[model samples]
Target: MSAKNAGSKPNKPADVIETGRLWQRPGFLIRRLNQIHISLFYESCKDFGITPVQYGVLTTLREHPNLDQTSLCAEVGVDRTTMADVLHRLEDRGLVKRKPSPTDGRIKIASITPRGLKVTEDMYEAMREAQIRFLSPLTPQDRATFVRMMLQLVEGNNQYGRTLLKHFD
Candidate 1:
């Protein structure tokens, strides 16, 4: 039978099935959802005068003080150049400081200033609320399960996560 006739019929050979348009594809929907989620988070961070990545860096530094640039880069999943740029911006804003390691001149340590901590603290509630809103559709248990599955998808293969990070870097 012709392809058009095959599609119109209910019982057709599997080989006669046609590929759907991109908009109707499951992958496209998932990608669009991710974009929406990122846009929402980015917009929320704008009111605080920082990008999502910048906020992540500040929060990471707060948790791990005096980390060297290389270590900080790894922790934040940013490359050396991008991390340096972010650090420079933060330093210019007087929110972070980079100092030569006392014992190792080759290494530069990064630390969050009081102002940085204060800014992050002020945004903590907003970040929490944003997360709640993002996950509002899911029950507590469903949210947990969703998070677990997402982590697995992102981190299951080391190369997969690294590949995704490369785009951001």
Candidate 2:
């Protein structure tokens, strides 16, 4: 021991070790990745002024056309309240139109407007670029593996999620 340190106690460890461990935790990493992707999406599609969920809703509406809000909720993997809010926002933006169902007066069927379709199409490249950027750090093979594993995890745990995903044939 050095002369100056002879009477001193050894230094205590930090209250919490800060480094790779937290970053490696699956929940933390997944949450962080989601945040990063959202940032990338916003950056790439800033001009469109639409969120990821909105884009998904618009795309689903474009495909299904005139789907009831409940159906949209299932297709978009969101709760009824969230779907309702999103629909209101899109309708205010004039990107979607909603009308009462003829058979069921209480239900509203939603359809993407021409403007919504155009916006969705225009935002395609940007969204694609954002996805590419998000996976850019991985090699081609690794990217495929990563995506496959992600799908597997999501599928396996789907039942536990708050949102329900509608499976497509």
Candidate 3:
């Protein structure tokens, strides 16, 4: 409701949200929600000194050992250039090692080091805490519903993005 309709009482959270009309804008809402999630993640996992992209790369490598750079980039849903930078940073930190693929010889392969696996394992709780905090405002049912809706949206629109995400199948 607008201030005129608000009846001079303090504006409740719902009223303020209604006034903004941001709820109707899906892109704006998605970006705003991403910012909130990133903030919560940074606050909870700052000690780990890792960003979500870095963690994704690490975890992808952990799951699929010796994946070539091109495949890893596709799986991680990032451009090759950005993936290269993340890989370089991880390599410099001694968390991952990159070498030529044994089969192809020319294709660069990446695998997480023991240190990387240890760090990723240790970060599980902190990241889980961040996820919990991000969804804390939602009821248990709403949380499940929200996640289901998100998956539907992503799966329906995956073809539009620059990077094609890998399917588990």
Can you give the TM-score per candidate against the true fold?
A: 0.74, 0.85, 0.85
Better of 1 and 3 by lDDT: 3
Model 1 clash pairs? none
User: What would the per-residue lDDT of candidate 1 be over residues 1-169, giving only the tens digit for each residue?
Assistant: 4455655755744434334556645457669977877777766666788777788889989988998888887777777888889999999998899999999999899999999999999988877777777888999999999988766655655464432332221
Order the candidate numbers by lDDT, best to worst: 2, 3, 1
lDDT string for model 2 (44-151, tens) is: 999999999999999999989999988898888899999999999999999999999999999999999999999999999999999999999999999999999998
Candidate 1's displacement at residue 51, Å, is 0.9
Candidate RMSDs in Å, in order, are 6.5, 8.7, 5.9
lDDT of every model, 2 decimals: 0.78, 0.89, 0.88
lDDT of 3 at 131: 97
lDDT of 1 at 74: 70
Candidate 2 wrongly placed segments (more than 4 Å): 1-20
lDDT per residue as tens, model 3, 22-95 = 67457788999999999999998999999999999999999999888889988988988999999999999999
Model 1 alpha-carbon drift over 4 Å, by segment: 1-31, 161-169
